[model samples]
Target: MNDKMNLYYLKQLLNKKHVMLVYAIVKMSVYICFVLFVFFSLFSIDFRDMQLSQSLIFATEEINNSSSLLPGVSLGYKIYDTCSSTTMGVRVAMALINGNENSALNEQCTKPAQVLAIIGETQSSVSMTIAKTLAEMVKHFGWTWVGALRRDDDYGNSGMAAFTEAAEQLGICLEYSMSYFRTYSQEKVLRIIQQIKSSTSRVIVAFVTHLDFEILLDVFYEHNITGYQWVGTESWISDSTVARLDKHKILQGAIGLAIPNTTVTGLKEFILDINPLKSTGSTIFTEFWEALFKCKYTVQNDSEDTTVCTGKEKLSETDNEYTDMTLMPFFCNVYKGVYAVAHTLHDLLGCNFGTDVSVNSFRCYGEEVYFDKNGDPVAKYEIINLQTVEDHHEFVMVGIYDSSFPAHNRLSVKMASVPVSVCSESCPPGTRKAVQKGKPICCFDCIPCAEGEISNMTDSIKCEQCYQDFWSNPHRNECVKKEIEFLSYDETMGILLTAVSITGTFITIIIAIIFFRYKNTPIVKANNSELSFLLLFSLALCFLCSLTFIGRPSEWSCVLRHTVFGITFVLCISCVLGKTIVVLMAFRATLPGSNVMKWFGPPQQRLSVLAFTFIQVFICVLWLTTSPPFPFKNLNYYKEKIILECQLGSAVGFWAVLGYIGLLALLCFVLAFLARKLPDKFNEAKFITFSMLIFCAVWITFIPAYVSSPGKFTVAVEIFAILASSFGLLSCIFLPKFYIIIMKPEKNTKKQLMSKVPVK
Candidate 1:
């Protein structure tokens, strides 16, 4: 044959070593046999599909076993692989046509078994020696490689141009584009089929009217051009006449953007009519068996299990798309959601479904959605249908859909099953639509929403943003509130801080009691008993104030946390300042002609302590009046949780309050340092000086930590400083005297106060 010589020359010219065509054959030259040339994946041995091959053989066996269909005919079939290529399929087809098993007229096209009909190369794209296109609708269904067919008129050309431009943007490539005119010859039509049979595209974008589409449909039917996905413009997509005219089922599952009012009357019956034993309209019955039964006839290449489908599985026991009519809504939306057009009935009773639908609306035209307590709409839908009532076509209510009901109970319709017409499946909840690159918005990849974001509805373009304290749950369906955090007494750190503060308070109280028990003693009297008692009281207040920072922050707690801290610390420091001044006065009174103790007595000491504490009180009040510390959530500190902490509003006011306490502490340190060496075993100045040193050190360290610490730690740091300073003052000033008074009773006498010697 000339075809064999051309391939030989082409191979010689290209210098190719790989086999372009390969097949197996049996000599059945006597009786007419069926040549079943099935398509198989050439590359990747693990992925080669043998289902179509099995189906052809199974059908042949089933037909031979059957007596009613072909009573006298004992049909024979020769199965072969076509390598899923048009050129190979053609060579194989030629070889089958020659009816030679070994060497034929074209040796390159050899391997022919005696056959009557050329069943297929399996896929319609390859069956025509091949076949087959959306830019959005095309890309939605992942038809990247496609062909374009159009009418010669302006309508077809303009529409196709738009589709082409969009397809190009969406990364869709057209292998062959052609037009169908009213004056085209039969030969021209055959050539177009020849082109389609040769092209590798499995999808076709037909931009022609319903009327014009008939011209090409006839040719398509003659060539058995079904299987390739068809996408049409609105001008033809909704035409029921064209859908009915498709006898070869060429446009069975066609989907595109348009309001399709067309419904196939015998669709259920037509779908159920496809049975391998009854109908020979299709050759790939094995694939259909696997799809309908949800089982594979053969184990996969990667799998070693011998388990395979029985092939005797009954369709009566299966509930698949073919049998289940209650599965979904037939008309699926790819671009936009189905907007509820609440068309009213004659009497305005209630909402209508389709044709004579009755709907009730506040304004009859307002498209407002009502929301529930959770801020989500509880949608109620009415199914509508067109009906002829009193010789007038009207919209009739058919069924209803209440979103508030449970999943299986939401819809109540009279119809047996719903038809789902879609370019691509819907993106379910928890996922957001990611538009395919170079494609339209409708053709998108369903990517899961990021953590902390959620998508409640199907086909959501963007995820919803959570509130300030809320976050997305694991499923990403709803926003749940984040965990609240603070330095509460319940936690480990909070319990420790609280215990220390309480222990420090009790210790200060016991020290006060000890001082009171020994009030008549020389050591207690010499250390200015009145100021000592007040100092102990202030230390106790300091310890207790820290407990305020241990619990949840609120308006009251926030105000108290800072103000109480400022006032109590200032009071404690002032008492030390008073004692320091008293020591200097006592030493000066021992000088010649000096009556300094008279002017600065216990009464004056009390006034100075009151005056020092009063300054802190005034600062705290001003801070509160202008800008008070209040409860605030620190979100940036941790992304997973909210930090329930107090905001020290107006840094100037907080610093001023703290600075005043530091000024008092610093003054006490200087004066105490001056009198530290001034006489006596019971010299209180030395003890006062050490206490001031600890107080100043603790407070000075607190400034940086307070500013640097995050969330609950900042509050913890402040409490630590308060407790540390209080303990410092209590131990340094009171512990020594208590040792003398209780442990060394001999030193608790007047001799100690007048000795003018160190304790050693």
Candidate 2:
């Protein structure tokens, strides 16, 4: 029973065999279409993504910041005494120099010097002298410790030895030691200047008694040697005469020294506090310290009002702001110096100090210096170009100087971060940055190859030179290659067709002789009229150079190549068409005047071919000169190279090329479809039609590709397209036909077809 049922199923399948085959073919075509769609879509998406990422990443990495951080705790202090009496000069002098020396030395040393605290001139010349000496010593030694002081000595060295001896008694070896001289005569001051100028050590310690600082200032300004840093002691301060000397320009770069109180705000408050009592007739400590340090007004208090002040005073006092001899606040540069060091240390060690404002003092357990023993900071110093807002005064401060500024209301500080190095040369060509600010030779970036150039080794340290026909810039970062140009269809394939025509004519002549010699034979007498016309037509079109390449031609020849190429292509197609028609008609000629035979009869068929060729020629000539065909004037950017190309006029022109090819493809497709029903003997039409379809497809797609290609390669692209078209025609259409007919004549006809005798 199973055998009978299987036989019945086989019979039914056999009946629908044609339908099954069609269904299978349709399904396979659908699968192919889907696969092509997905493949192209993915390719396009990836290409777009690659292009976008290139621009964004390149733009973002060029400029970056590297600023350091501020320290957490209040590291140091500045003290200023503003009393305009005997000590004012000393106070002002000390304010400029004291902590500044240590700051400068810290900059040069291989380590940062962090001075945590500072106490200043007891608002006096005597105190300023001591402060100045201490600052010089710190500078000389490159000490990094925080320093504090009791006061200065316009009270003279009367107090220095006592203070030192007292500190010594307490087992505190003075960290710093210094000296000074005091004089008053102009001759003495000039002699002192001369003496210092002549001395081997070249040191100036101004501690003159009763001599104004202006005389010394005038002498120094007149002498102005480059490297002198004039540091003064107590007696140098309280003199009123120096204030009259123009400090802005004369004492501009001079360095002074003084002890500064811990807090600027505190000192300001103290000034304010003293301001209220100035009119009260109340004796304050400010008044006492001023007189004592300035060498004026000895105290007679015994015990009266002793809570506010203690000490002897100077008898000389002046009211002139410029000439006041009162011991005033020594405005300390140490305020910024100390703070700067603390902040720098914190940054170097990556430490946070603390956040409280009132907490007056700070210390580090094992303060790590960001330097070696050379007193040079390990970190780089940023050279600042600072200008004062009030006076437009300008100066440079290396490293951090947020708080420790000299007098004249100028402090050197800015928000910009210190750069590690000012400016280094951009990396040499051929290498790219492996990482930013990284040392070269290690972590270096690679130079990419330029266009029209390629490197075999992708890891090449330097880009290789481009091959012949190519060149790149100095860095070899880009490349350009010599372009290939086809010029036009006439230049290349036209010559090729001419050669093919000569060869084909020779073959045709040989074949004709052979046919005549064997005239009695039926196969020989059977004329291949289609091949004859094709050979003749192709030969005429190919040899007619009158119209093709000759630049200056009569209107006839001008009209000639256009018609010739059109005729040649048409004849080429019609030859194949005629051959197919001939074969079909020969088999079906028994039926009278068949459509193939009638439509393609010798004279009518030739005329038809001529008509079609002329129509194409007319259309081509008209289109070639119109805006759609010849839009752009060829521009010559290079001296040697010239290009001839058809530019699309507009969107309409762009679509015109596409539309023309589409029509040709449709015609070839229709012919191939109709010819498919024909018997195998006439199947040559199928091959010819398929070849035309391939040619049309290549050019139709090529139009867009050529148009969109960059100018550098657009001409090359057109050349490639022409080459591909010619090569395809020669190989696919002509090569196979010649292979069988000329190379192997035995396969030209079947034995049965040849043996069948014609009935006369």
TM-score per model over all chains: 0.50, 0.32
Per-residue lDDT of 578-662 in model 2, one digit per residue for the tens? 4445555655665675555655567765675566556555555555556433323343443223333444444453354335435
> In model 1, what is the error at residue 398, expressed in angstroms?
21
Off by over 4 Å in 1: 1-431, 440-453, 474-476, 632-643, 752-754, 758-760
**Clash counts for all predictions:** 36, 61
Off by over 4 Å in 2: 1-588, 592-599, 628-645, 650-665, 680-683, 696-709, 712-721, 747-760
**Once model 1 is optimally superposed onto the true structure by TM-score, how far is the C-alpha of residue 308 displaced, in angstroms?**
56
